[model samples]
Target chain A: MESDKKIVWLASYPKSGNTWFRAFITALLNNGEVDINNLATDGIFSSRRLFNEQTDLESNLLYDEEAKQMQGNVFNHICAKAKQRHLFVKIHDAYTYNSDNLPVIPTQNTLCAIYIIRNPLDIAGSLANHKDDTLDDSIDFMNNKQSVFGKQEDEVNTSLQFRQPLLDWSGHVNSWTAKLPFPVMVIRYEDMLADAFETFKQALLFMGIKTDKQQLETAIAASSFEQLKQKETDYGFKERIRNTSFFRSGKAGNWKNELTSQQVSAITSQHQNTMAKYGYI
Target chain B: MYYYRGFGLIIASQIMLPELLPYTLTSTPDVHISIGKTPEKLTAAGTVHKVGYAINPNEYLLQFLNVANYYAANGNNIIVEPLAGSDEKSVRLFLLTGVMAAILHQRNAVALNAAAIKHLDGVVLFCGYAGSGKSAMLTKFIQNGYKPFCDDVCLIQHNDVKAMAAYPTIKNWENTFTGMGLPIPSTDNKIRPNLPKYATYFHDEFDTDALPVKTIFIIHKDHIAKSVEIKKLAGIEAFAEVHNNVYHRLQIYPMKKEAIHFQAISKLVANINVYQVTRSSNTGFDELFQTIQKHL
Candidate 1:
């Protein structure tokens, strides 16, 4: 059935397979050639430029609640003005509401969301590298309820991304998977790695994106971790963390070698319920 | 009434704007501001443009929810209507920033959302979206003996190819102050109660005179860059970058003055060197500042 929803959120915690999924989708759109630097989609949901263009106000002048409210308004504005059959917007923010009881992502405009989840154990190392912090610190961040990204606390941040409330990893996952206002499809990062074709095909079918077996296989081949790594080595990835490669290994269960027993236990204990549900234990 | 000189215009306002550089000359103001009733919406007969704001020819209106009721800019006059719960300081903040920016657009000037510093040879502007570290970089240059010409709003004089001096204050977050190893100055004017940024005033170090535009650096902070690097932009890339950095660009588009704005920016870019500064988050303040200094 053709879905009426125009907006689909590629939602995930940082270091999850969100970007990889985006790359696959980009490859599918571009006939099996993916440009790591330039994707088919617009930037992330919290992009300050998008916020400014949609709201016509400088985001720095706004308080957090005002910015959140504007984010909802901008989403509706985008949805109303969109010419495309489907718009995929990557969002790192957890599903939450502002003080006014409005979803940070407007429910009316959001047709559905694809929430990509990754193992906390695997995410710790990748997130640590991306943030240039210790693995323990990354674990701590994953547990901290007040964890926020792109905050303008220090130095007026001029980054294109705005303040995103992650609210910890389990919180992030649960927030999106809970009684969402719209339909949600959860895809595990590990599953995507094991069976790329089936996993991605399911996601595409769910988003109502037309695809053939050849297109799906070609996209899978083009966006493979090795191919992405080669592209990163050839031309730098804009989203790569400082002093680190964006396609750093993409290996699952590296926490087996990297995480200390204490670190592993800490993460497991903190996210035990969610980890067990996702078969990460 | 208080008189301030900014954006090459003499502004007279009923409220005291301590952030602006006081206009020294005894001349009639070009723009006047007062507390008055403004319409909830613009009723003028013209193409209504809505971006982040709704505007019509000769009139612009914006509301900041519970903070303020409305800010209206018409011709050379501005009216600030405060919401019932809004205080004097919050009203003035919106009036000075959003209202002033709208008025500048109404005046058909090329304004940039940037911070600038006056060097020995000429002035250089740092352009980026808010929180892109323009103010932080300007503050860094100021602390290192360079003089600040403008804080956030930069108005370009296309004819003379100069950058106009804006207010004599810098709005910075408390973390910025602490990160730079400086104390947060006490001020009653917080940009917002929940926001950590405060409007810090500068005195003798703030340059009030317009200076020739020499260079423009569009800054982008990357979490993954190994070091702070500067790359020169050329051709359409330069134009596109500069165009995106225009202050209140959305407001200008609605005024049907985009051609004029483009012409001004094109001329400005043609004469001055434009570079993109990629700063890694882990780069030390001193190192980042030194990299910019070497380029300057």
Candidate 2:
């Protein structure tokens, strides 16, 4: 295993700008000609197939606790065998420990992480559209501490990803940023939309990736919201929700129009302290 | 000792396997399983590979962590050494699932990680990654008057276009049994203790004999898919899909048997009708079954 295989974490809550960040990095890596299908990184962190491929065992056979214990090993195995110098793994799971008191994402080979957060109000609208639920339901889900993605007990979860524990909006944000084992660069989704070039460049610098000004500008231009939405319109994205575009309304504050006043108040009330700290209010 | 018939082979085991359909009449066992001493590490080994378990093909050793250890030779005999403090059920489960699959692979059989049911046409194999609704789909077909041929693992005999039946029982989550209004069978063991799924054994609807495979449906769960859609797969895509679903494919590398495995899978793809069945998350089992029935 080469030390040059830089393992950077692309951490984000659901419906955040994680995909946009990945698109920008992919475009930059591909010299501004990005393939929507083939990304620059290896894969997402919660992929069940990757765990099976790495461990030679069916992950679904094991208990959730047992599966979490092996996740760190899976990451290490992938890092050891990676051919690329830098690997960006997108993770929806909050930074947490397994039953054995071990970090789900091992920090032994991890270089750093970039946590992307969005305003709870805006996220509520996007999440509602993404999940095909009501805005109020999405808000409640974000506020619920027991929120988990892919938590299927009745039937087998056949998707490529595994069950990810996302404690809540605040818990998710704090999990990555507070008392972290490795260095993490917190970039707001609003900032990315406000100043794409500066925010993206800062994120790249945090990952220790060196690039020229032309490359940065090209990546930003190539991954612009309009261009991305156009690409999605031309050839559909695999990650898109049912009958909905993945690049749906990349505006910063569409919640004002989409969310009701009561819904907005509920989101703010649930995530008040964290939202206030991040200037969401 | 208990004798069981599964995957067209008679297995003589020291431990009892209630999951396998009883082999009433049998001659010599094709595969033998017995408790024996297993080395912690292979001494004379070649190309050692570690993935939860360490496999050294030169020494014919497959060692699991603190559970059970296995060594196979001549593709007909396997020696099992259960680790300290490991219960017989846990050891048996590992042997029946992983070790048995590995032994079959060594024998040059095209074993797939899938479940099968004896449909009206022929055996319909539901192949995909674990939790891809293979067992769930098989259960639905079973409830609809189809007999379960095998669950979790299916061995494909390419020469005759038949699928060899393994265990008669299908492991399913608690909710699945409840959803179908079926009583949960009591079992001392789980797939794993923390996992809510339990082993549901079938007594009357078990088909011990092998069935000719009519179609292989690779199931995938699509969150975005609104309805059940079945698409015919052809060419490289079909081959790749089947290859991906091959049981114990990782053994192909450490065992240095890629050529034979590829040849076996290629023959299977040529002979079998393969399709990709995408089921939406929200689709009811009855509706999905009807859609599959319509396609058939």
Candidate 3:
């Protein structure tokens, strides 16, 4: 079998460093010129438009479960038709097995996966802002194993996004970091903030992208949080939820001031095991 | 078999498509849909996938897992093999969507993903992705005394640059009906067993003729937008708006209809006025209606 590893999965839970990393890549691809509006990458894994384009079928007519079942094939088709060396796909769906007990993302065409993990403590506050909900509600959502994004009511399943099944925060973390057929590189959000050049360089090297220190520094500076947030302020981000800013704060340990003691305890206790494994505890 | 008139063609189908106008005139059907034996795979096709489909220059095959396998050939015939116990409504829905689009593209028609409203001597088209309030605006326009031309797919004929009214039905989610203060019909009209979308037949108000293409509005809703803004697109921008709205653009290349699609879109763009309309998500339809009414 020809194992053509063409797809690089940028896997993460929402509010993790997925978009930021994609922005950095976009800058690198464009000689350190970042246009936040038009980020460079294959779109999100859950785009209904991409599915329709690849399969030549209307995704709106299919049920969510049926759509989920076809994702593996949809991705494989994407890889087969890819013209670039690496097809960087941003995915929020947890690494999960489908109804047929097979991996939702096929292993044959996968090159590598960059799984971005963040402290659930900071994530609760950031997620609250992104979802335009209460912090406590966001905390509860992170702890709920049944949590899925873009799952609308049956009456209005007309969104351009597909349903992304994201289990609880810990489950989301473990799903990507677990043993898999292909290589998985886990990057902590705090680490990326502490040493962005080193962290991003390591990820790019893992995907066999050749870059020098100067290019890395340029891309990092261009994709910095301040730059991204300012761009969003000037021209709104389409990915932003209703009335809420997408790039709220890129600070690590933001939970120190934002999250209350009760909220911190709630996130830590629920995600203690996985949090400890990733050095969050 | 049942016969219907749609997309400037007479369609004879074994399955009943309630959305299209009934064809009572005795003439040769341009397309035929029947249940028959379809090859498990296409041998001469260029692209084939494990997801149950194949495509080539003249033929396209689609298999809805556990539902049916549809084979369309040369813009004239569609062969359907329904799985046992499959319902007719589901089969008919697929036929109207992907199969019918393929048929139109095969015949070199410039079909757009738009909703058209009949004006004085032409049709005003509202084009957008799904959930961009196209249907809501269409329903609103109908209530405000504009005649409905086409609900989802608007077919523009070549040489004449006119918008042909194909199907007389409008399909919308349950929320669209309740949002418009209209009642959804019985559950039997649901498009699929598990989907909450229903088909509303508006045969009485449907214009069964073609109208000249007038103006096109590419609509979008920005959540943070404060007010509605409309801009006229000229030259390349106007051309792109029509090209981007092609109903079956993805299949054009695979079917070797690029010349046909490009020529049709190029010709249509030269004859129509295109505008981009942006509105806040919270805004009501009245402002947009009034703004577009001025342009019309």
Candidate 4:
């Protein structure tokens, strides 16, 4: 009965245009009341928390089979709670949910997916700014990549353990956008900026949510970059992201100025086909 | 330096370990036994030689040795569980080590030789022969929303606060999990593949930091239509059901550690409801699953 609720997941490798799109959608639904503060981001369109709170691993205890089994029913409860209210949830993972990794709600059933693409060069620049490192520093860290972070907002502890970051930009991107099980509508950050209204319509059609002239105008005005960022202060829910502003430098072509020629060539060469296919170049 | 003597037991110099641990550091003649908890775990707590075991390809042995040493060095306790063995001493040692670890891990729930999975309700045990439907039951239960606990081996820890189940991956069927098309049982392998690289059907969702146990089922493949009656078994009959229904026969070692083995099982079987289930070819596990649902 629950899978009947058409769950459309907003998925990306990490830090694509997911957060921006999330803010946009939230604005549209809440009558342009994009809460720059309330960072639970709602249960919608956010999959990373579901993942974190669910997965089980070995620490070598005698055996507690029961605890391991109920590890991920978070969404089940949420589904029950949201039956009357909303659809759409967030999943930060890039991997497709196969039967091998069955979610309580069956992630494969997620029919509509909004995958946001960003120039990796810019993602690297963004990473550098947040971690307070130079581009060379971040690239060196990326070179040792094995596991990638699930979200841009995810914390990397450079604290007691000095180590390299988990994944290179290209590998991270490929992981999020590969062999998806459902019908996906891919949009790029630059594309959204160049024609915000068009992309908005495309997303609206994808979600089956309709709007008139005033509703559309209100959603756009509320999500405008400067206006939303301004609400970051004095919003009670904004405290979670206070550590690293989720809205850091919300513009494009910044990758051109921020990345060195060598860095550009590296990411471009690494993501040659993806960039060409997505028309990012 | 001034030293105060109490009980004339060299109270002044030696660092006081908890009263539970026996530490003898003096090395002067017979006075210095220089005993250590050893570089290995004291499985039964009184054994003289704590055997170090590494079973694998000469390749795997080296890796295990490295792991053993790493764990031993950490000062956290280490025990070498019997790896499905023939050695009488080995089986007893495995049970001893498992029970001791369970006891040390907490105060209440005793570790026993069974498998379990947690439901939204409470803790449940799946008991059966190696091929009997235990893992299959877990597979079904997990698909129907049961959280997999331990597959073949279980370690239960309990106390006044709560009874927690361990999250251990158990092998069920051989095909890839994707071949099954279930929720989470499939989506969860991203971080840890519950299955060994060469094997399949590993990993499960974990719930609760822990939960309490409430029921046990002794599964058999015999179909219910085959005239096998499903009934509640109790007392020594229940004990026999759990022991004989084990995934494997007692490794000779643990069987020889009869006291610990008996005591651990007694502690476990005494608490929960146990049933001897004969599979009806017609019923599949529907009857058993319904039975569990009815109670919990």
* Candidate achieving the largest lDDT: 3
Q: State TM-scores per candidate.
A: 0.91, 0.90, 0.95, 0.43
Interface RMSD per candidate (angstroms): 3.1, 3.0, 2.1, 21.5
Give Cα distance to truth, residue A157, candidate 2, Å.
4.7
For candidate 1, what is the TM-score? 0.91
Candidate 1 residue lDDT tens string, B1-296: 88887666798888787777787758888998887777777777775635445777577877667766455555588877677877677677777776777788887878888888888767999997665688888889988988888888888886878888777778887777788998886756477665567887776666656689989999877765778889999877888898988877777767777888888988888888899988777777788788778887
Report model 4's TM-score to 2 decimal places.
0.43
The residue ranges of model 3 lying beyond 4 angstroms of the native Cα positions read A1-3, B45-52
Candidate 4: global Cα-lDDT? 0.48
Q: Please write out the lDDT profile of model 1 over residues A74-171, one tens digit for every residue.
A: 77777777788888899999999988887888787677899999999999999988877899899999999889977644435455677899998899
lDDT, candidate 3, residue A138? 95
lDDT by residue for model 4 (B185-247), tens: 342332212221111233234443445667778866542134446778888988887666432
User: Second chain of candidate 1: TM-score?
Assistant: 0.93
Can you rank all candidates by DockQ, best first?
A: 3, 1, 2, 4
Evaluate all candidate structures by whole-model CA lDDT and list the values in order. Answer: 0.81, 0.79, 0.85, 0.48
| Candidates in descending lDDT order | 3, 1, 2, 4
Clashes of 4: 56
**DockQ scores for all the models shown?**
0.44, 0.41, 0.54, 0.01
Q: DockQ: which candidate is best?
A: 3
Docking class of 3: medium
Model 2 CAPRI rating: acceptable
Q: What does candidate 2's lDDT look like per residue over B10-51, in tens digits? A: 888777778776776559888777889976665555645555
Show the lowest summed lDDT stretch of 10 residues, model 4 chain A. A156-165
